[model samples]
Target: MAAAKDAIKNRERLLASVILVSLICGWVAGLFKHHSDIAGFLKQALPGAVRFDSSEDNIYTGLTHAQSESKKAGFVAVRSAHGYAGPVTVAVGLDANGKIVNAVIVRHTELPAFFRRVTDNGFPGRFKGKDCSDQFEIGGDVDSVTGATVSLAALAEAVRVACSDIATGRLGLLPIVKNKPAIQFGLPEILLILLIVTGFAAYGKKLPANTYMKWVVLAASLVFIGFVLKRPISLININSLLVGYWPRWQNNVYWYLLLAVLLLPVILRGKTPYCSNICPFGATQEILIKLGGSRRQLPEKCSQFFKVLQRSLAWIAVMCALVFRNPAIITYEVSATFFTIIGQNWQFVLLALVLILSLFIARPWCNCLCPVRAVSDYVRLLRRGFTR
Candidate 1:
């Protein structure tokens, strides 16, 4: 009892230490390194409202880029709400007469391409000096960002707030930064910390084997799986349907849409549906241990050879998808001919037989073969605040 208590106390201390260090590092990295003369100008332009990121030195590059056209269209915005990932502070340009000018994306808080819905093909440029009447309207005149409407709404709000500041003489904007990471604020850092912290929370400590908790976790897991695997009605799964192209590339919207509607209702009906009750992949190893009143430790030959190879392949699949940007490779094997060939290959069938035996020995597919769940595990770790 005392050892367990001591361990818990140690965990608490470790959590605190990790959080503190992360915050300090993120704050220092976010500020005080890169200089922003335009940020200084924007600071002067709108004190206590928004400013340039002190990290990357690119505030004024926006103004310089727009200088040639400022006389033609002119832009004026003290702040921008339509951010890349989250809300951001941006220097909106307008014509001399207070009309909106070029919408220079001053800075954003998300990774480079996550918000491709907003940033792709210069989507933000469309808003340059857009009339106040134009907001979230659906049409080619205003293209829809695939999976990120929330970002757009927030961005619009940010811009409105900044404009209000200026209109009411509560703010002004004359100065700006030089280049890159156009805006800086505390919220983004704090949010990043919380996100990392959530990762540990999602990791979850080993809990007592209470039946109730087991049911809850199982149900929660199933519900999560159902939602993610649901076919594409929106942008979240657009990648599934897209094969890629140029000049008005297209998506196989109908194929995925049909699968979603048909498969969802049917899957919800079965005792375990596609995932296997208790998660075949989840419960395989446990079942194997108690198979038909006969159990034995896996032979070293089987464990050492297959287990290591499976883990290595899984890692390669995940890294290729994550680092090399190959979702097609990441999500599934993705070849009709490959699927056909899988059954015919003798080695593959033998592997399947071993997996089935593993169902008696352990969760064979989940431990070694499944790729989606592996990625989910990583996201779950981050969500639970377990990086510490």
Candidate 2:
């Protein structure tokens, strides 16, 4: 018992040391790369002939530029707003008349595919003619993207704030438009909350664990969360939190509820209800397992080694995200493929292989490579450590 305890302690210490070093190194690397990236982005986004002078204010850091040819002056403000995965830094250009000239995404940690969607759909173009006088509310005046609503909303809000800063601070104009209400509760949020509550009731043994009940939950997850919402919790979600990129609570009720449902049970009872009961990919794998009606167990040593590999991959994913400030770079999970049905060829192949393997092995992906499970295990370890 004493030897085993010593081994556990040694392993925990090693893990903690590795994580600390990785985070410190990642932060340093990110710092060096981030400034150059921002400078390049600002140059590209702004007009070529104008020289930009940094604003004197510390709070609203911006650039004041005067056109060499026309002598027209404008301001470029860099503002950040909360996106679905993280904060999006946008550069907003305002002419001296308070009219928006251009809005460009300077830097963001949003998912690459979603970012592409936002760009392709001309989300930034909508703000080109708007001024501080226009209300920047989505659905009120500014239209939001269908799939990338949160990201679009965030970008719009960022531009609005930047324009407001220039209008009031630089132009000496009084604020004309009232800020839009932040909170928005819709069908998606309601359904997600209900789904989480049902998962808790089912997993907590408050509801009967009948076959029908399981099937109902599985179907709901597959259809609503997977196909319709396309909002399955992923490694990127955890990475966003680790990097201190919290979703705006007022505008992102769905995100908040999902996190609460996934985390609270794990912290309190060591129960990963999200993975075991609520994950759409897990449901799909379970369905495959049932159809295959075959099971295989690896040797204890092999299982232990795979578990270590799983946790290591999780660590690598988080570190990569931290270092690069891009969640898409480290997103290896097949959940997006299953939920969105639109991803790279490599992702498709990976999802196919995992589903095929799930026929013989129960949750092969979850056991070997699921980053979410690894995160849940870490939370469980924390819970156990605190209790001890």
Candidate 3:
């Protein structure tokens, strides 16, 4: 028994080392190819400007297709802001008098569907002719994109900040003094906190009443976290962690709160509190299992095979995300589609299949495809390797 334990420990250490090395190698390779084409980005932001002068403080003077003595066409300012999944870099072009010529999304790690929805709805076009001093508030001056509110806020802020920098530094205007952002502690935050607290309170308790409480929490998670808020843990969160993409804390308190809730138990006890207790998708699957009366379990050999397949798919997904430096690249999770109702045709098909299979299979996606579970497993392995 001691010999078997030692062998198992050795294999786990080896697996941890391999996973770490792959992640490091992927990150390094991605760094070499991560630079955006600034010239192309500027051209898109400021059309009719043939040439750009030297950049000073991220502000580039745009020159028309005229002689050297010609007046400046405009200025392009580059800035980035925290989006829903990661940083969104934008280029804002402003005329001599400080009116916006155009705004273009240079690069972003946001969900591709949400970002595309914003762009397709003429979100950037609405910035044209706005003055540097104008408020770029999502619902105040700029119209909000439905389903992409966080992304819209980030893009708007990126443009606004860049414009402010240009106005004060290059255009010789006063600094735009804006009020500080208040902490957004609202219903969503309150509900999530309550749910997490309830989950932890009920953990490891054998009280009969706790069983009823468990069902209540799960139902609440399904309704609020999954449907109402449309914010469930996904691969994007894992990719963001690996890529060091942190959204702002003031307005995105729920984001940090969720991460802490998901990871704290794993780091402390090698337990996945989120999966068994707080995940809305997990709750959905459990409910499905209850309704379908699926007491079936996969055979030992089959379970092992599927587990290996799950780890491989997850590893490949994370590696691709790191190499490309875009969290949106890892969007195979069906939770996003089910909650947001915004995904590609294939994703919808996959969601339907998963739901249909949930009737008889009992949490097939959680057991055989969740990247979060794979990540949790990796964290547990590393923790055990270090502590033991």
Candidate 4:
């Protein structure tokens, strides 16, 4: 019976793990799944037009045309730049006398509303008469939009690149960069789904996996990386995405869905998949555990200090998290301001040390702290005496 119980427990953990992984993965997939739709919606909401050419009777064309009057009047390229998130390509048409003609967003990797900074309110029109030596930095000759400085910088960079090309007479040779797409339901997604399904089949009815959920998890993860990672890849960015764009119209739909998936593993599977498999942020923290595996020395006196600090921090964060109705703060505990701003260099080292030492101490971070796990643990309590 003891052996059977252990097997059962293991199965629960597997299911729980799959659930946590699926939630995170699915979130990302939704983004990629609807990326084009999102872009199109934005375009319809706010519009910008692109102009081609130095002046009247002349134009730079997307596709080369045959026997066209404008095609024959290709003029010298004098591009403009603005800083942007990644890179932005803008085509600025100048008159024969280097007078500004028109500007348009040719190509860029910035988010929606972000591109507007390039062609907003005659902003691009401002470049018409200025020589190449005019100042265009933010708050200078050109104004930077709020909440889009990086994207602005990237656009500026591209403009600079175009100008360099013009100087080298390579404007005609500018190569366009387009986004590449991933398979909608590729083999990886299929395999992951199969693995999840097998777990559910073996344990769904009797143990946690009685209802196979592994496949669902596998699918979510693939989508997360493909879609979510593209726009909200970084820790801060993802956290922001969850908060800023979490579907909140009808009774906080996105937040509730995330809560259900994140907490499901512990309740049904008896596993900590959130920490074990799905969380990229947690994965980064675990590096410290691996690094300090061999040479970890315990300080008996200071042990209580770390515990107190961790616990106090957790409660404070939990309270704030509870009030804000945001779960990101819980994740932030493991990666607080110290690690985020001041102690960044040491983050990798500390995470490695803690993760490796956990092999001996049974998840020191999860036990002493880890806001997300704490939430899961809290949610699990409500489900006591139940088996699902």
172-282 per-residue lDDT for model 4 (tens digits): 333433222332344434444443344334333333643234433433443452223321122222333443333222322333333443556667766544444444344
> Which ranges in model 3 have alpha carbons more than 4 Å from their true place?
1-5, 65-67, 206-208
Candidate 4 stretches greater than 4 Å from native: 1-244, 247-261, 267-312, 318-343, 385-388
Ten contiguous residues with the weakest lDDT in model 1: 242-251
Q: lDDT of each structure? A: 0.38, 0.77, 0.86, 0.42
Deviating ranges (above 4 Å) for candidate 1: 1-35, 39-75, 80-86, 96-98, 133-142, 162-388
Best by lDDT: 3
Quote model 4's TM-score: 0.33
On the 0 to 100 scale, the lDDT of residue 161 in model 3 is 98
lDDT of 4: 0.42
Order of the predicted models by lDDT, top scorer first: 3, 2, 4, 1
Compute each candidate's TM-score over C-alphas: 0.36, 0.84, 0.94, 0.33
Candidate 1's TM-score reads 0.36
Best by TM-score: 3
The regions of model 2 sitting more than 4 angstroms off are 1-34, 37-49, 56-72, 122-126, 136-146, 172-180, 209-211, 297-302
lDDT of 1: 0.38
What RMSD does each model have against the real structure?
A: 15.6, 3.6, 1.9, 15.8
